[model samples]
Target chain A: MTMNRETLINSILGLALVAVPLIALGMDEPFIITLATKVAIFAMAGVGLNLVLGYGGLVSFGHAAFFGIGGYAAGILASHALNYEPIMTWPFEVEGTTQMIVIWIVALVASALIALAIGAITLRTSGVYFIMITLAFAQMIYYFAISWPAYGGEDGLSIYVRNGFPGLNTLDPISFFALCAVMLGLAMAFSAVLIRSRFGLALQGARQNSQRMTAVGIAPFRIRLVAFVISAMITALAGALYADLNRFVSPTMMSWHMSGEIMVFVILGGVGRLFGPLAGAGLYIILEHLLGSSFEYWQLPLGVLLLIVVLFARGGLVGVLAGERKHA
Target chain B: MFTLFLEQLLNGLQSGVMLFLMASGLTLVFGVMGLINLAHGSLYMVGAFACAAVAAWTGSFWLGLVASLMAAAIAGALVEILIIRRLYNRDHLDQVLATFALILIFSEGTRWIFGSFPLFLSVPEFLTGTVMMPGEFQYPLFRLAIIIAGFVVAVGLFLLIGKTRLGIRIRAGEADRGMIAALGVDIDRLYTIVFALGAALAGLAGAFVGTTQSVQVGMGEPVLILAFVVIVIGGIGSIKGALIGSLLVGFTDTMGRFLLPHAFATFLDPASATAIGSALASMLIYIVMALVLFLRPSGLFGTEA
Candidate 1:
């Protein structure tokens, strides 16, 4: 809200995240562009999850369901388009489209619907029940995707070619990276706007004391459900973009591991903070790339690092570096 | 057809019993301590690995089982003291995140020690035979033993929780942590003991399961997810809920897999039926859970969410 030291740092961090990819493109380092794309994608997912996790105080462990749903939506659409078949051949025929904008919409709508259904049920319970139920739902979807042979099943599906954007050569890594950065920027701005809105205030209030919010005529349950759905939509959108970036989609993208990683990004960045996801995702990718090159068992050290953060650094990397900034 | 159904039913019961063993520990820990240990699965993995290693070394299934119990107990105690105690007061998200980190650490550390390849534990020679059930069905002796072991553990837990002084303290602690602490109960030691007890049960479950399935890294995760479903369907902190929920889920999952193809074959071609059936079958338990929670939000026997 205010341009304080932390705010300045957050802006710089966000800029650096974008500028680094641009520099890599100028230097013709495709690998760095790919990595930056990954950082932006993961951060976007984290930003989405943070809506409910940090702001709404509703920990939906099943966010992977939405992410995976997003991936499958894109994968399925592209596969059907490649095959020249209608995705749905019931009362009406619906052909798949390889258009990025269309894919984003489909992914967003599909994930939002799934999220709505899951949120409606899971939102009834709070605390640990919410967490586990969300997980169970995600696992259910994962297994379903695995068992259903109609669209690649456990083997996963791939687009014959990278889906196209309006005017950009989507195959070029830099162009793709720019597309992801733009999405992240837009998502970040959307989140910032949502945070400043009345609904966001109510959600935060509900997080702190739902009973008090209720006493003040605010329905915490409704606030939480809306926030949950919106979070899932954002994550699902990220999932679609991620699938595009990789040119493949699989059930692994929807697995609990993805959900956990998404949470880790948000936590590692700084929960409830706008730039936190960006910072966290950036740090995680850099650490992963560095450590993965050196050791086969990088997760052990990463786990230890995460443990230290949870124990000692309660605020995370962004929180530690930027002392309690109000907003992005 | 009747024999086939009966065999599938027995299989369901066997796996249900295994689920019971796993879910019991989770429910007990939740009920007694209010801590959600995602690393509970890692402890199961530890038990399996310990049993596998010990059995390979000593060539004694009994000794291996004992080692699994001890390894899991010690690991549980250390986890309790080193990390879980601090998380008791934190929010559920922090606990989830912390335990999740423990999972990564434990999983990788185990992988470092055991290597990534799966280890197999053989059933002891004595229990390798099949036993005849009523109406001429043959069931694996080892699986039947798992069911019996599950029954034994269930009864033991019932007695321990229903009659023991420790159980009273646990109940008191659950009812009010501050009151129990004020009453001069050694809360720390009690927590460690309870956590260890839960971990031992999980270890035993793992050891029993390892003979049938390979002792692989990440093996506990799928089972852990199912156990979580069991507890959620049963209620977060209710053993009775866990037991009933496990049986219901086990039967539903097992039967759905066995019968869904046949059921779908009536309406669709066999190939697609098999695919659709299995797809729907895999989702049946979660559907049941959602329905159960919808009807009874606190679970059938759970006192609270």
Candidate 2:
């Protein structure tokens, strides 16, 4: 694996430009700011998924569960704060924190806990069973969200104001965008570091050959489960940010379609690439914006495009431009 | 309480049969072709559309049913030839992505042709009423007919898979793909037949369901999940498992919804009971599946793979 210095330098330069939108505050371009924010939020989610699907060799079709859980955490917390309701009462009166940092922490913990339970069970099986079980669990959460009417249920809940940040007005577009961009960068950096770490190496190795990993004295199950939980936590945090950005959260976030779209981003960006999520999220949103504006049947064209990509192109967009699938 | 329980049980049986119709084809295809087809739901949607369209045009429910089966089978075979056949040696992810692409194409194509509005079909006049049971409870006769039809198909499938020359070929294909092909069997044609057969079953389920509810785009997805649950619970490649698994899931899901709320109401407030019960009821099937996998990872009827 020879590293190309020029290409690496160019990638860094390109990524630096991604931050240029944060500086466009004087222009008052809400549209560009919002779009960039959306791209960042989605890319963060994609990075989370790539860890499990690409690095851990586990394709969880139930990621929407974690994503939705994150959103619900933020939404439910905000609603509780707004209404002066105790979130859950016992020895402690749980109340929503208006701070973005605190909300993200709750989201991360909630998602990680659920993932831990789900992964513990799902990791016991392999192949199709694993896929179906994850899907079933996701559907369970989706149905529960729909039926539970306390916090708006199927109608979804809306946050009146964006969650706060210490020194910045979060309602301001630039501040919010910066928050999301920082989180996205952090998630991406986390992924890169994990892939280079010993656990990351073991996870990748398990994906390549579980039998050989076991023969080499590593338990593939434990390694994959840890990676899956971390992956879910990252996605969950992104979900919280996404809901804050929209000021709304609903069961739709938990829907299987959301799960599918998350996987699509990872595949579209070139599965294992560190920047692939950012690339894929950018392309997806751009296509959605463009094709949505141009024609009514945008999904049809997008579907056709995806088919061609799967059939003819082995690697995703990154593969097309950067060559073969990059090794972790 | 007893009457409501009976009604729910009957509902479960009806849903189970519909699931079996869809799952049988999927299990057979997987057993023989070693392909994981995500486009099976598309075929189901196609069938429902064909049934609804033809029923509306000709004003004949029977004709509509036949058209649905034929259209779905033909569509399935065409898909097998054009796309699925090429995917025989591909990895599961590739298969998933390709079929996922097909889903988008098929769903968008259907919406383009039919528009986004849902199409409705009426249950035939003969099966529209309710049948009185021995316990003085009445249930929808149409649902009962579905159960009967499912059993008939199950028996027919059993005879076909276990007692016929085609069955032998299918089993041979499953057991030894290379050896069977070496013996000059047209494996490609067999795969096409299996794929078509699965599509036809999905069509039948869709047609039946369309009569009860409006046929619409994305209608096949929920049923697709149930079908997946059936195959997973039954064992991926086992027809018998699909049948049993569907029944267990259907019964458990229905009964959980029916009974759990009542049980929770005994202790908790009615409002909380409803929310908590519904949430727990929804998780019941998955919990059962997790338990099953824990006890027998290969599923009840699945062979050690």
Candidate 3:
């Protein structure tokens, strides 16, 4: 792909997302920092979903299960650590963890495992079947979370104090924001690399033609299963950070509404485009801020804008500004 | 023990019928239009809200029910003409997103008109009492009525889609839209009617269900989720698949909810038992779906694509 006006716009968007947050920090605008933190976390979740939704041609409506799983990982671990309880006792007695790195690893692994199970079953069917099956799995987890009261049940789990990174003062908004930004940056880089990798090609090939991909000796199922697992892992990381940001994790985090929001970010930015999630997340937050402040019923107008975008802007905001969907 | 089991069976049948009401229209729309409508639930919600509002005004449950059907069918038609028609050619992602947007609009729109609090609709007086079975089993008359209504509609729909010219047109349209259009069937109008018909069915479900559960803004969503599960398990395009699937789901869910906690209670502490039992019970239908998909990638009645 040759660089053009779209590429330029993409670069500006990537830089703007990171720079604006830093600027907000420098200017001591705590609210902006918090908002930027939200943007980064949501964008990260979108990037995770983009792997399967855009590149692999999977439209999962149940990504919130992974997100919620990641969230509960953090909340459960932190709670257990605070209250001095072992997480798992019979299988070698695993204790609770308060460290961010440990929490993220646990979140990633737990989410990947769940994704593997869900993806294995769901990948059998394509189109609407794929969509609904994934949704069913997510709802399974959502209902479980709501009913299982060990942590909090209908009322979500809350962290009394922020879980700590190795050296950072997480209590400070800027520090937490910086941590989230770094993870978001790493995930974005991973997305760029994965899309251009041979595995990425195989995944896209399977999406385009299962027959040809099969003839070429690539098992589309295996490729998608791996991609789906990885996608869930990344989204799970974002879920952990989001829970930390709010210092609370609830069934709401895993609700279908949350899954929709994550999808909206990817679509709004530009599916399959580098930095689309970032741009989408930023734009969505900006819209929320603008419309929310002015109107009592902002969701109505937001819905209208979304309809207009889907109807007219096939590529999305990133697509509109950058370019239409082109061959990768 | 027999009566208890019988009551669970009846409960399952009652909900199964309501689910069939929701699933038939959804399957019909999906089978024919190849459209995955997320806002189908919103139409259901619309039916309930309209029924409740009108019933309160008219002070008659029967009137409310009619109002629900009219309001839902009209809303469905308008949505089809205005929004869904343009979406026929787009990818599934676009359809999902656009309909998802409709959900937000419809939800907030309803909230805008009616407050956040739920509205109640009483079952009509004549249907309020319970009927005694042969030996000490008493079944609620209203539930039995809903079951009867659901079966009547099922029979009516089967005949409508099988015995009539319009049904043939719909079947032909499902098989090949282009071929039907070439035969001078006015495909666009047919599509609109099919969509409205599906919406009317969903509206009927919402109205029927509203009499039992409170009418609220987001109430249609969980039912929508269940309906989706039913269609998938039954196969997306088959009405027979939908009926069987709904019954299976309804039975499994009701039985699981009723029996699982007791099974767990015999072993674990009541607190943990209830929690874990409820969790597993809620997940039981999905487990059933996964198993079904494992055996048949396309549902039991679904044609393999």
Instruction: Give fnat (model 2).
Output: 0.56
Model 1: per-residue Cα lDDT at residue A79: 89
- Compute the lDDT of residue B216 as modeled in candidate 3: 95
Task: Output the lDDT of residue A184, model 1.
Answer: 94
Q: Which of candidates 2 and 3 is the stronger one according to TM-score?
A: 3
On lDDT, the candidate that comes out on top is 3
**Per-residue accuracy of model 3 over A27-132 as CA lDDT, tens digit each:** 8798998999999999999999999999999999999899899899899999999999998899699989888889999999899889999999999999989999
TM-score to true structure, per model: 0.98, 0.96, 0.98
Structure candidate 3, residue pairs in collision: none
Query: lDDT (CA) for every model shown?
Result: 0.90, 0.86, 0.92
For model 1, residues B80-189, the per-residue Cα lDDT tens digits are 99989988888788888899999999999999999999999999998999999998989899889888988898899989988999989987887888899999999999
Every candidate's fraction of true contacts kept comes to 0.75, 0.56, 0.75
Q: Which portions of model 1 show Cα errors greater than 4 Å?
A: A1-3, A325-328
**Stretches of candidate 2 above 4 Å error?**
A5-28, A325-328
lDDT of 1 by residue, A106-200 (tens): 99898888888988999998778889999999999999999999888898999778899999999999889889999999999999999889999
**Alpha-carbon RMSD, candidate 2:** 1.9
Sorting all predicted structures by lDDT, with the top scorer first, yields 3, 1, 2
